[model samples]
Target: MDEAKRVEEGLAGDGQTQLIKEDCQGDLHKKLDRNDGGDRVEDAPEQPMAETAEEQLQVVKQKSKRVATLDAFRGLTIVVMILVDDAGGAYARIDHSPWNGCTLADFVMPFFLFIVGVAIALALKKIPRIKDAIKKIVIRTLKLLFWGILLQGGYSHAPVDLSYGVDMKHIRWCGILQRIALVYFIVALIETLTAKRRPILLEPGHLSIFTAYRWQWMGGFIAFVIYMVTTYALYVPDWSFVAHDQDVPRRYAVKCGMRGHLGPACNAVSYIDRQVWGINHLYSMPVWQRLKACTLSSPNAGPFREDAPTWCLAPFEPEGLLSTISAILSGTIGIHYGHVLIHFKGHSERLKQWVSMGLCLLIIAIILHFTDAIPINKQLYSFSYVCFTAGAAGIVFSAFYIVIDVWGLRMPFLFLEWIGMNAMLVFVMAAQGIFAAFINGWYYKDPQNNLVYWIQKHIFINVWHSERLGTLLYVIFAEIVFWGVVSGVLHKLGIYWKL
Candidate 1:
């Protein structure tokens, strides 16, 4: 019986049977078929390791289509920026802040900075080699720095007063570009140096190597600490630009050779700025003077010195060296949150929900708080101002993400995306008198016969209750129309200008 079974098994060991066994267990088949007879059959080809990796990469690419939320958020921010900036004035509009607090207009800059930070986090993931990454960062940093200086040049052109005999030098060293350069360089360096650091506890666990650099909370902490300490130390009442009492102000005025009151020369910040930058070219007027004016205001209705105290000397200029720290902190915080959304996929939904609720509550709290103690002021970049503006920015970005990314909705207004793509070009055009020149042509004319003015009087004023609303709508319509033409050209030519 055993011999009959063995003969039957041997008969079953044909090429078809062996092929079936090999398909089930290739390793076992290889060992069984190592004989002369078995060697007659052909061996299957093995797949290369590189081919497997390529397939895995293709899978990742397909999965990454959902990250377009960042771009949509950026586009929304840019649109708001353009609208607020081009508005003739905030009067009778939902825009503009109340005294000493923020408005819809205040949220734009923080949103821009946050978008930049998000880009930084995404870029860190695509670097093929560390050396290449460092090189790219250096190149971008230099470009931003150069562009910042060029923008500063815009403010440096002395403001000529043909009517008045005053020949004041216009010092334009500190501005938007300068701030961008400072923030970009510092944030980029932080990202590069800490490239190999471990992920934070709050970060998402399912991220790929390309998405692991979202841990920017450390940068945020550093920026906040530096800004608070530096501003407090340099601008506090007793230690720096602020006055301790009336006696101190009087003593400083006496020392500066001014009569009873302190003039610009007697003001510590102005004097120092004039000394450092020279009287012929002091770019510190608006900011430093504004700060001085605020510090000297009387608690009750009474006379106060026009000039800042001697302590103000330390942080005398508008684009004062120290204030940049706070601006940078604001940017870092924005970037940190942006990176969190991009890298960690696990907590994003929860984060979105929390951010939405938090921002709504924060806006309410800020409005209440602004009623007393401090007013929301963008010029000062006050703590409450930062909180209020950032909260608004958060809400805006979150909404964009929900609609465009989560819900997979299309951007019907492609023009906004176009403007966003060429944001630098748009900004430069606005700053360099191009848009002003065009708008002035449309809006201004001799009283005898102006086209837009005539249209406004006959049509808009006749139809609308408030002419202001009509005028605003006209301005907004013109802006959108102009942007449509510019964006169309940009899209056709594939022109994108980034810093």
Candidate 2:
């Protein structure tokens, strides 16, 4: 239950800033030597005989070991996720990519999984025995699973509805945190089982890349391939990424074929979910009521399918069994990137390696998208979807690393560190509609004069009288900042929620 950092600790530059010289001895060694008649160096030497630069590097590396950039990247993901989740229905673009293609919203979940992978490498790197690592992994996995269930199955609302309220009759068995925990368990087990390390050459001469965990890497490749083959061959009816008007009857629609093929009755993912958890336990999100999705349906009850409690239930879980495979691949890819971070020593090399890997994944993802091998579909957790999102994540993390770690621009992101410090706590609270309840308490509308609306309309909306713009602004100032302040207070008090 590690609190992944949103910003590096103590990054206002008190200490830990030093130029990484190509060789430590070239300039300083000769200048301090009395026998060689070197330049008169008035500097206080670590030893009368220069014997501790490497030693100093090792200690500094260990003591201030965190990469500021990675923490900021992790922080960015956390904050953006919270923002999107609490957006209060402003822009369509802010939402998840419907079925296929990548979007800003879609990137949040994979980035989270990726960070988990990186965190695993950082936390478990120096452990001496597999048994110790297994013990810790089991504890963390169980904690995540338990919390995920509590957040999803146990947590409830006053009324039952899709999108916002919980339906006790149809409580979603799977969820975001549940998916994360499950993926973590799978990847952690893979890393532990394939724990043996062997060096591989990716540099010139004797220089090698990160100590190659070839087995883990191979496992990632195998898992990805399996996902692809299964997606291609094992589709219930067929592999499809088509969008159809959810309101219309199946026969009347000008269909993409894939859509009608993956209809509520025929979709393989939904079938798996139905068989495993039953439709009653599945999430009956009212997408039509909330996001105005043109190409989705609720067979039980909705504007599209007005026949309440009908037999035509089009249920699909974004975090279903099939998609979990892709989630694992997403996390495994992150573990590989973590290895790159650990394996590469020089800052330049680190950036180079990360960028190159990102570009490669993006290229493959695009190629797959065009070829119809695996379109970027989050519902199915398509291979191309994982690739595109993961590639984008790597590039983003690299940029953060460069700006914050390399260039020392760490001030703006300090606030995000607050959210990153106690991310799970904040996430759970937000998910349980705690923030919404707090907002609702004072956010009432009456015939006389509504207070919350007055402030928003007069202050934010009156600019252009565009309620959308005003609403967005109000959300940023009110919800986002409010949560940030709470997390900051908790961080200051050294209170964090883990297992």
Best by lDDT: 2
Candidate with the greatest TM-score versus the true structure: 2
Candidate 1 residue runs with Cα over 4 Å from true position: 1-66, 88-99, 155-169, 198-215, 235-320, 346-350, 353-376, 435-467
Each candidate structure's TM-score, on Cα atoms with residue i matched to residue i, is 0.62, 0.74
Q: Which residue pairs in model 2 clash with each other?
A: none
List lDDT for all candidates, in order. 0.46, 0.59
lDDT of 1 by residue, 169-261 (tens): 443455555656666667756776776673543343433322454445566566667655543343212222332234554323224433211
Model 1, residue pairs in steric clash: 100-375, 100-376, 100-377, 101-375, 101-376, 101-377, 171-283, 240-311, 241-311, 241-312
Candidate 2, residue 413: the lDDT equals 76
Write model 2 residue lDDT over 1-499, tens digit each, in one string.
Answer: 1123222111110011222122233444533211010101112333443456665434323333345555566667766776666453566567665456666778888988887776655444434467866776677667766766666664545112212444566567787777887887777777776655534235553224433566666667787776666554544533222122356533221222232133333545665676788755665452223222332431112354343322223445777776787688788878777766665556787788788888988999999998876677766777788888889988988888777767778778766766666666666665355545444445335422444456667887897589778877776776567777887788778776654
